[model samples]
Target: MKNLKGKVALVTGATRGIGKGIAIGLGEAGATVYITGRTLEPSDENISGTLLETQQAVIDAGGVCIPVQVDHSDDEQVRLLFERIETEQKGQLDILVNNVFSGVKEIGNAFGQPFWKHDPSLWDAINNVGLRSHYIASVYAARLMNKRQQGLICTISSWGGLSYIFGAAYGVGKAACDRLASDMAVELKPDNITSVSLWPGIVGTEEMFRFSEKWKTEDEKEPQNSTMRDYYNWETPLFTGRVIAALADQQNTMNLTGKVQIIAELAQRYNIVDENGNRPVSLRSLRFIVPSAIPALKKYPWLIPDLKIPWFVLQWTMLQSPKI
Candidate 1:
């Protein structure tokens, strides 16, 4: 494993999915991981990942993980979370991953609509979780990292940020986040702080599995269960997790600063595979395109229409869907 033995790392949205995977990956490599989320309970639909489970996973992998609950959308809460980290962990933060997200309201909306017709609250929600939260967390992380004069800050971004998708708020939110990473990298470079945006190709998460189950019930014709072929095709959260571990182990890691790297490319460079030990390929490479699906969309072929407006939105929704 990468020699993060005495290092400390914080991962937002670490209760489950990609965040959880990365947290566990870091832990497996011997780092003390702080898992942050909105809440600890499963009733909080906005926060489905459980901190306890993440901590246990890390311990089982022979490392330490501390679960901390915080709503990044709230400035005070964000500050407090970092304060606790400083007090409990104390000046040992080596890696910071901003993977927190809460945009459930946009689950089934039509992306072709104009910004004026969209829900105002959804825009605020997206901006809060997707963009602003990243900034707040990064600001605090940079402050601490500057003191050490060396650290890595990786922000999870999507391909949508690179292309035009739909809805001003969603698209703009990702675009701004991409810039945030780049701008932070530029200013913090002299401090030996590496900041960059990394993309998770197409993760099949718990949300994806739930969406698939619900979609299957709505329509019997749609195959809710994945065949072995489908299983090998999509990106798994672990693939990105392993890629992150590799990045954390890089010799000239700063050379990648400020760049928005695709997870597919990273996997190739590092040879990351899924839990099954098979390489996970991107949809485009597999000659497939997923949609911004609802719980029932998978059962009905009609719901599989192309969602090309803001690429990240579709990726987010697809990844958020329950992955069986």
Candidate 2:
């Protein structure tokens, strides 16, 4: 891996989930990471991770970290955050990871609801946090990176974004984000600031753990007996974190600029694996399978199908697609 000892990174939503993992991973590789989040701390419940935890992890990994609290939904707050980075870091920024998100419950609940029955507020929340936040942050980062003439900006999107994933609002927001990255790449490529959107395939975060527990059946009792749960647990947010680290350390990262990358692809390139160092499974090819299986996938009532293409074809097609 290339050494990024003096580089600087900013990760929004760094307080939890994949964002935190990426931030720590970058820090581990010697990048000075700035971690941001909406809420600093929750007084109630088991909120085990915080931006502070991310910072500590970086420190433990022999890297530097700074935690900042900001609500990406607020334009003014985001502006201030960028300004602080500019002034404090002297206008030097290398990696910008946009991973802020919220309103999960509202969107998830809208899965089966008809379009007309959907709440506008839920859409608003998802758009603000999911779409607008990414755009605004990218705009600001592009401005800064353009001046410096080099940077890497990665937006966090999801497989569900490209197709129907129960929650149309959230999925569409992510889809838009993917396009945003491509558009940004077109504009920023000349400036040497590579912009890309990427997804962490089937991450097993705390929230996912909770969700899987709920997704299981009390009467089925298979979760209690089988090791199926372990499959999903194969990769954690940390896996993607290390991938970001490798990306930051890449010597010719600009060569692959302006694309929507998936975690599985990166893992393969860098030989990154699950916590146990095993090559975790990736759903990159599912996009193809999903489109063709739409009827069956929906009728069978498996996880929401997010693509219209067949899984095998999707993977092959993506690989053959022209890279800009």
**Which candidate number maximizes TM-score?**
2
Q: Candidate 1 — worst ten consecutive residues by lDDT sum?
A: 286-295
Superpose all Cα atoms of candidate 2 onto the true structure and report the RMSD in Å to 1 decimal.
6.9
Candidate 1, residue 99: lDDT: 88
List lDDT for all candidates, in order. 0.72, 0.74
lDDT of 1 at 24: 78
True lDDT of residue 274, candidate 2:
61
Q: Across residues 231-273, which tens digit of lDDT does each residue of candidate 2 receive? A: 3324678788888878877777777777778787788788777
Error of 2 at 298 (Å): 23
User: In terms of TM-score, how similar is model 1 to the real structure?
Assistant: 0.78
What are the clash counts of all predictions, listed in order?
A: 17, 8
Stretches of candidate 1 exceeding 4 Å from the true structure: 42-47, 109-116, 164-167, 210-232, 282-324
